[model samples]
Target: MLASLAMVGLSLMAFLSNSFGQERKIDQIYLDLDKKYRIPEQWTVLPFELEDPYKRIKNGPPLVNVVNKAKVEWISRWIANPKKVVPNAKMPDLGLNFEEIKAVIVYLSSIADKEVPQVAWDAFLLKKDDELSDDEYDKMDKIYNSGKGVWGRARCTICHPIKSVGGNVGVGPDLGEITTKINRNWLYDWLKNTKSHFPDTMMAQFRFSDSEIRDIVEFIMRDTQFMPEEADEEETTEAKPEQQEIQVLTEKEFSSIRKDNALAEKGRDIVEKARCFVCHDVKGIPELMPVVEKKRDNLAGFEKLLYEIRCLACHRIQEKGGTYAPNLTFVGNKIKMGWEQEFLQAPDIIRPLSQQMPKFNLIEEDAKVATEFMDKYLLNKELPQDVFKGEAPSPEIVSMGEKLFYDKGCNTCHAEGTKGGGVVGPNLATVGDRLQPAYILSHIKNPQQANPQALEPNFNLSEDELKAMVGFLVDHVKKKEEGK
Candidate 1:
């Protein structure tokens, strides 16, 4: 049955390729796909406006000339054997084959030849190398090398981007422009423990020696030109007097100081005003019972239940919710019914480096109801038959797709097998099994046709490239079936 379906799909693809003799533009493909699928207007979610805290820091410091040989070498090594640099790191496998690995290595080597822009204070150290005496140069080189090692070992690239290199996943803000916004003292305190500043921050604490921390700080602070001259002088002068005069408080002294505040009354006032327990659980808040009751009442129907659970809090259905998880607006069209059923029951870890959805442990009746609703209502039944019943792609086309996959840096954001890292995009390891060929082609051509809020960028691929990419993905499904 599966083989027959495959043959039909391949034949249709061949016909479509031949019919469209002239190369089709990406926009044309998008229009055609939208005409067929007709994205449901009801599923669309509009974005809400929020206050911006970093609005004042929009402009960054001027670019500085700095190059670190150690940093470049580390990038090259990571490109070659990323797993070795960060063991057990769940990243995309760029080296799916030798050719792909070679292509990536060549790209990294080219990047190394170019001078790295200074984003941190460590760049200053590199800039001073030419002016340093032989002994001083050697010492600086040692410090730079140690710092680069610390960065690689910590897998900082997984969450942060440094210039054109590193992952694009914005789990944390890009450290590439960090020096422009913060000072060394603040950076030091942050590195020591982020939670001390922001109680709800997601950053984890790392155990490093004080010297190791200093090395990392120096490397990060390399581009210190951003700091105002007056501010620098003020900080330097104030440091000594403050350090000498400051009295250290014992644990008992701190506890006594905190006890003087009438915290219970203040807490009650804040909770009453803001309804803090609506999203967060606060102990001993009897007033929150009514809110909990209201939520329970809202979960009476399927749609209301979905809203009550805050499905949009993580999954973007029609671009309305949080972007932390994969968009599910067209999930019915993407995933098979059986697979979706199983997935909802026992969610698997697809993106190991990023957040994973917890198992809902829903009752059988609720699961069945949700599954049925998705299967019947969410499907894009109007997709062309040719998409589902097309001719298999030639081996040559599949090879072209493979080359394009790495050349275009698709693996950087979208993980396949074990090569890519970060959850900036969905895992394409089983995409072939999940998505229809026509839907895949449409998505690659223009993702907004399906979901206006999708983060997947349109590469503006020509007719041949689109066909080849789709073919490559379809072939992935075939290989999985054969256990290749």
Candidate 2:
């Protein structure tokens, strides 16, 4: 689907040899049966396989439909230097010259499964922004603004970073300059059904209506942030030196050689030599790892939810999955089941500074399944049922806690009441509704003990100070009227 390359340049060949030469010398490592056949000590025999999204051998998106997904020109630029096209791109530069890149594009085109359906756009919307009539511009702007609102509600940046910012979830690609990469048609199809393009993708399948999808598409296409920034004229003139311009494969040029079998075979050979199959599912090359087919027909409850939603893509449980989100190994003992279920259905801003959970548009049944799974299995025995002994703390203790909270500068990171604070930690305005009193007390006592990665500091407060702080935080619950 993406462009191809043949030979590594001399410099790159030398670099790769130097970097991997030691491993190449050790053929014995592969031949040693003891090392090859030995079961990993960290691995455990399970009743059934739990799909780890992070552990996929083919890390890049499948190339079977890349020809339809990306433009030949964009693919050429990406193959040349991925980071130059998108700043956070993970694909390393293969150092392919122009001719090899063209052949690869031709090869990708030959393997395409189907044509990309063309999307109908308004005539005025296709016009350049500067060329648009005032009336047409206003109409386009209205749609763009509506799309912006939808983008905000969906919290696209929770996973996807835009311009090197707001990818706290750390799973999605940098979407900044995405406008230069894919066409509106591919984007529209992907948003409509991501699993169809990449079945193993971790992105949530949001239940967006057709109009919502269109609006989002408009915003993404029209937004300046998604487009690459133009270089300054003076800076370009004052640059140290002009490098040789790399030729990009045009659609016209690619179409000419697209059906050439000899060229495609040569491209395939180059791909095999470059080991492109290590990261991508190249059509002709044998996959380095066998694909594990998963059956979802009989899956029900949490197990089904995990695969469908790909929760482990962001979250970790019992040391498996990703660490981009909160560890759920002890979630049962940490959060109130009622709040957990409600949050799963309609997630709110718990952590304003960190990555907030995206609204998955879950049904009541989905929420029930998730909460039930956590409550039954995700527990920490050391955590008490209630640190307050089944009773609310006295008003005096809460008042004292409030003073201690501010005195210790807890508000520097956490927000409380009507006043906003630092966005470094979870907002404490409704902490009582979400967290169990016991977990809060325990966490505050030793932040590192609760979460080794937590930035929360240990104040080493006296027992009374600890109790007072917990009392104050617990009092931050929503009022009865506000709960509605």
Candidate 3:
């Protein structure tokens, strides 16, 4: 019996050694590919471990993190057929031969633990009928699949994730593990009336019926294998501090909130008359077909120029326009007047990485008119006074902020001086001189409020942390001037 046990141990050791050798071979192939293609880190698909799946695990000697065979096959197909997998991926041809691709796929597949469920990719389509009776399960499945069209048409995948699929457009939180994070009833309520929970969210109201909403919730939760203990209905119903208090408003109070004034009415009329909805979706205006085919012929000067240049095609105002450019609704309150004028005239790239905004080549006269129009109409008049009244940061505070800046991974997205760490976000060296203190504070707290399409995530900083970050950003100009 002792001899047999010893032999079993030896066999296990040999198996592990062979596994390690195979993994090393795979790593060598990856290294070769990396050297040849100079592939971006985002493009690199790593082996997924069943336990602690989200965290990136370093490649172990015996390949601890197993890659599913299905995932490997999916990835192989994705690389070969980019148009099918990721239609919008602007990747250059990898120039890899079929043999090289196959080898890599085989290597990836070798790491997979066959015991694990094949639900990493295409998990969204999964309908675990075993959870319910046959008849009820069929009914739910039909109802759930019926809402798939709505999901695609709404571009829900653009901002959300369902296992390995979907783009992280960064407009909303990842919904991949949402079932584990949030309760079904709460999710249902949120789907029905998002504004009630998050008053300033950019998520548009989906006019789905009760049955459709239920179906969607079911579909989202179907593949959730591990539900957290914290995902209680009571906990989900509890509002965050930032969320507005739930209250029943009288007609007068509701009217007060709406605040229909002459200036706003005039602006609405002008926007409607100009047929801005053709290229824009202004917040308050009802959707209508253009009255005239040759609308540009009737308008002249700045109005005509605005439409001619197709400003609405890029820039958004009041959450109503294309998402490619920055929201200009509250730009007047955020940017200094002089800086805005200068930017309009010169049109230099504020964020070197972003190529969305091109040089307009506008003459001084037109630039000035545009600047004045933005300043006058798009201004936020009710900005809080406290943001601008803070004393210069103490040395200790500045030191803490400096440490926190790196600790918080702010450098990953924002460039400081010449160090371009990441290109996803804008440079911050000159931000202190450009943006208002109040706007900076508000933007840091909640970026989505300032720009619906903003990719800057809310870090949920404490008040002290918020102050420290704001001080660090605001003092950057002073530090630069002092040659610190």
Among residues 3 or more apart in sequence or in different chains, the pairs in candidate 2 whose N, CA or C atoms overlap within 3 Å are: none
Per-residue lDDT of model 3, residues 376-440, tens digit only: 66666555444537566677766777778889898988876545567678777767777777788
| lDDT string, candidate 1, 1-484, tens digits | 9999999999989998888865856787888888755646544231222111122121211111111222323333443454544433334333323333233223222223234233344433544546877877777768866876665555556445554344434434445445544455556666664433432333344556666666776667663322223457667666454333212223343334333334434434443444434433333454554222222332343463354334444565543555656666667666666656666665666666654654444556656766776666555555534342667778998899878888888887777763653467767777676666877887888888766767677889998898888877776663675688
Q: State residue 364's C-alpha deviation in candidate 1, in Å.
A: 5.9
Global lDDT of each candidate: 0.53, 0.82, 0.54
Per-residue lDDT for 268 in model 1? Answer: 42
Cα-based lDDT at residue 459, candidate 3:
90
Q: What is the RMSD of candidate 2? A: 14.7
Per-model TM-score versus the true fold? 0.39, 0.84, 0.38
Write out the backbone clash pairs for model 3: none
Regions more than 4 Å wrong, model 1: 1-301, 304-309, 318-320, 362-367, 379-397, 418-424, 448-456, 478-484
Using TM-score as the measure, which candidate wins? 2
Q: By descending lDDT, how would the candidates be arranged? A: 2, 3, 1
